[model samples]
Target: MRFATAEIDGAEVCGVIEEPFFHPFEDGVDLLEVLRSGELVAAGKRAVSRAGMPLDSVRLRAPLRPPTIRDFVAFEEHVEGVARAVSGTGVAPEWYAAPTFYFTNPYAIAGPFDEVARPPGCRVLDFELEVAAVVGRGGHDLGPERAPEHIAGYTILNDWSARDLQSAEMKVGLGPAKGKDFASTLGPSLVTADELEPYRDADGFLRLEMRVAVNGEVIGRDLLSNMGWPFEDLLAYASRGAEVRPGDVLGSGTCGNGGCLAELWGRPDRADPPALEPGDEVEMTVEGIGTLRNRVVEGAELPPVRPATARPRDRER
Candidate 1:
């Protein structure tokens, strides 16, 4: 089932996507509520038999606002490419020892077709193509073998980035904070895990084609099979000493090779493509899931960054 959230009659509701139409749940519940109730699959099935509206008639939102977002660096090629580009090095040894992730702002999530604003003072806006698993059942200290059961569905994720700010801040050993908190996109639909059963391999990894394009021109392409660490491993690792709750989202980071300009810039054979500018349209597609398209727009006036000034100390007489 392809689950989605859409705005209709000035209200946001959850629905099941059926190609040219969307079948909203009869109970008028939203996706987040459905997930928290542990009734996503059943609710989706019930929605299918009801009348649906034309897909073009309504506005779409992020499938649901996640409770928390944990984005993991699961692809070695992406790590190596980024390291070489930014620091002139290969993958860090620590990366291989365990799956590493960072918490990103969940409140800033955007839906498919939403307009993303170029962060203020940002010149090099970039996109990281990824896949994310939405948690279904809450768990703590889950083993790798059991983590898969907790995943409710999957969606395409674009980790919008401000590369220049990210570069400056990381040098201070702190954040990707402001550089990333501005906007991140997800959706078109949330595809249930069962829907992807056909693509699952013996290792429990999905073998799916993933690609990204800007203004109709393909820029990056990869297979989901290329991920160095599986989602189950990442989830299990995430659950250590913490709870993975319903509506929590876990990202597969960027795919291998050149998923973003930062990675492309590092590759010897590839020329850096122009960074995202206002009016640029980005479309990311994953097999079994769906295409998520968004446009970049100039943002409104942002708060000014104040200069740091030391306070004058009282003169000691």
Candidate 2:
């Protein structure tokens, strides 16, 4: 069942399913409580609703705060293009030896359908569709074969990038931080790995259907299994000699040939670029997980909060 966390009346709450099939499990489940339980929330233990509120109405929060760690561009094509676009080269052999990443401020995470204002200094904003894995248990230095056991569930991650800023920092060999970390959006809800099993394809790829629409026009589409660097390898490699814990998120990087800018806009080191404007709305979706829709407004003020009493907690029957 899919679960979501939202803020109503200044208190953030976990949403569980009261029933199933209205987009998987619309029952309200508490994410933090479920992770800490060490066992899946027993079926019939929570409530769900299909006729629930529209995703646009709720105040979304990060699915998990203080996500253990964040990984970057794992897809060879996306990385190859990014490198050639900036440095005029292809994949670095060093990247394949071990997984790599940058630490994002977990506090900066916003929620699905929230309004994302353009950062004051950024004229170019981009959206990336990545499958994020949430750790269910903690472990360190685990081998690739044993990696799947540490997974908790999956959620949509928008690794929003500031292209102009990112291009400038890579010259120093130590960035994508100021460019990437400014605001990373996660959620709608965290769906346990067990729930994703049914969507798996014969090729061993999770058949998590995904699409991105800009201003109601479709811009991106692909299946989750097409990823070259699967989540299992990222987990195993990332935890090698390091500790990974529950509530941490690992991004699958932007899908190869699936990104609007990374693939469609250019061919190999030679093409024009698209810049995000003040009123553009970028919406990314993964079937079963739900949609993350955000509008680009002038980087000005954060949206106001909605009242608590107005949002009633629906419980499972």
Candidate 3:
């Protein structure tokens, strides 16, 4: 089942999609409510029995506003490709010790068809093509083997980036913060794990093809099966010494070698694709999930950050 939140009659309603239309649930206005009620299928059935609004008649929103979002670099090719272009290096050895991730701002979440604002003062804006798992069941200290059941569904994730700001910040060796605090896209709709069962393999990886385009020209493509680790391991690792709760989102970072403009950035030998500017459209598609689309637009003005004044430190007591 594909669960969604859409704007109907200027009001947002949570519902299920049978395609060509979206059947909104009778009682809830938020998808999180349905998850908490533990009536996913029942709610969907109720929605389907009602009169559905035509898909084109309503506006789509992020499936749910996640409680937390952990974005991970799960593909080796994406890391290596970007690394080689910038530093002439492959992935850091530390990357192999474990699946590393960074907690991004959940409040910055945008929907599939929304406008993605380029961070104020940003020029090298880029888009990452990936998939994300939405936690359905909550758990603590879970093992990889048992983590699969905790995932409710999957959706397209676009970890929109400001490469220039990211590079400057990483020089301080602490963050991707302000560079990433702007926006990240998730949706089209949330596809339940069962809907993706046929694409799952014995190896625990989903065999879906992911592709991304800008203004209709294909920029990158990859197979979800190429991940260095599966979603199960990612969830297990995420839950270690912590709780993996419903509405928590886990993103599978950039897809492959050319998944983003960063892959072509700074490589004089390569024909660099132009960075995104206002009005540029991006579309991402995963074989089982529907297409997630967005347009780039000028961002709001950013107030200048004050520079630190040099001051003497206090003597050790």
Order of candidates by lDDT, top first? 1, 3, 2
Residue pairs that clash (backbone atoms under 3 angstroms), model 1: none
RMSD, one per candidate, in order: 2.1, 11.8, 1.7
lDDT tens digits by residue: candidate 1, 122-221: 9999999999999999999999999989999899999999999899888879868888989989897889888988998887788999999999998999
Candidate 3 residue-wise lDDT, 1-317, digit = tens? 99998987777788988889999887645788777667777888888998887888889999899999999999988888788766888789998889999999999999989998889879889999989999988899999989988898999999999988888888888869888889989898999999999998888799999999999999888899999999989999999999988889999979885788887663557757889999999999999898988999998887977888997897875
lDDT of each: 0.90, 0.70, 0.88
- Which clashing pairs does model 3 show? none
Q: Which predicted model would earn the best TM-score?
A: 3
TM-score for each of the candidates: 0.95, 0.81, 0.95
By summed lDDT, the worst window of 10 consecutive residues in model 1 runs over 265-274
Q: What stretches of model 2 exceed 4 Å from their correct place?
A: 18-30, 43-60, 268-273, 300-317
lDDT of 2 by residue, 229-272 (tens): 67888888778778887777898888766565655544654464
Once fitted onto the true fold, the runs of candidate 3 whose alpha carbons sit more than 4 angstroms away are: 266-271
